[model samples]
Target: MTRRIEQGVERGSRITIFVDGAPVAAFAGETLATALIASGRIAFRRDGRAALRGLFCNMGTCSECFVQTAVPGRAPRRLRACLTPVADGMAIETGAGPDG
Candidate 1:
């Protein structure tokens, strides 16, 4: 199920979470923030200085939209929530800055 956002596929459905070594259910078609917020898992990211940040802008351009995804055959990578479409079993990690 997708929300009508001016001809854009912007919504998701119920899904799951992989954070801090645990699995949680997340809403499909929902942004990571939307799902996390619904599940009260809102510490979306940590800044370079280790400051916590959540979905501030809710758009693809913000650094706060970062999420780590478990891509098959490739190393895990950071994806922007505002731009990525959520999958049924997508694994996401929250509140960690990129490794230096």
Candidate 2:
């Protein structure tokens, strides 16, 4: 049961980002990895071996958290979830990578 802690920390404006076509609530400044983890979506994508992978070395050094993201009129790209910030109406595709 993973959840975001909203105890005493100040957060940015609440927003929504789509993950695999499903709406995920997030804050304006939160990293995609943070929001996805809080949503209990551990597997960001599948590796070439077909194994599920999530955030590892979350500071963006490791490539374990790649996911596809799309912006209007732009080609979807594989991005490191840990380094990408969440934006309102942003769309993410999980487990839809080349080997996924």
Candidate 3:
């Protein structure tokens, strides 16, 4: 499991969420789902059935963590938020990608 230091985040500090086009700001140290939820992003991705889904199992197992992450120099990729660490300047989208 990944360790989180909530108090480590500075007061009023924010991180950017790149959802397709707009850049949204959320508090640092929050999970992709938590951060998005705080930003009013209720949907994290689409299931194989095209059903909207969000964080379910907080642990690293389960399909609930699926998210498409855009990394520098790499193509957009589907990843598990429960297993990924949020970094500054990350571009994330919810929904099935090539890997999903």
Best by lDDT: 2
User: Runs in model 3 with CA error above 4 Å?
Assistant: 1-12, 71-73, 96-100
Q: Each candidate's TM vs. the true structure?
A: 0.66, 0.87, 0.68
- From the highest lDDT down, the ranking of the candidates is 2, 3, 1
* Candidate order, TM-score descending: 2, 3, 1
Clashes of each: 10, 0, 1
Candidate 3 per-residue lDDT, tens place, 39-75, comes to 5665778878897787788787776868887667788
Candidate 1 deviates by what RMSD? 6.7
Residue 10 shift from truth in candidate 3, angstroms: 5.5
lDDT tens string, model 1, 37-96?
655566777778887777777777767768777656778788776667556667777755
The lDDT of each candidate is 0.64, 0.87, 0.67
Winner by TM-score between candidate 3 and candidate 1 = 3
- Candidate 2 lDDT at 44 equals 93
lDDT of 2 by residue, 37-97 (tens): 9987888988888788989999989899999976668888999999999989999888644
**Candidate 1, superposed: residue stretches over 4 Å from native:** 1-14, 71-73, 96-100
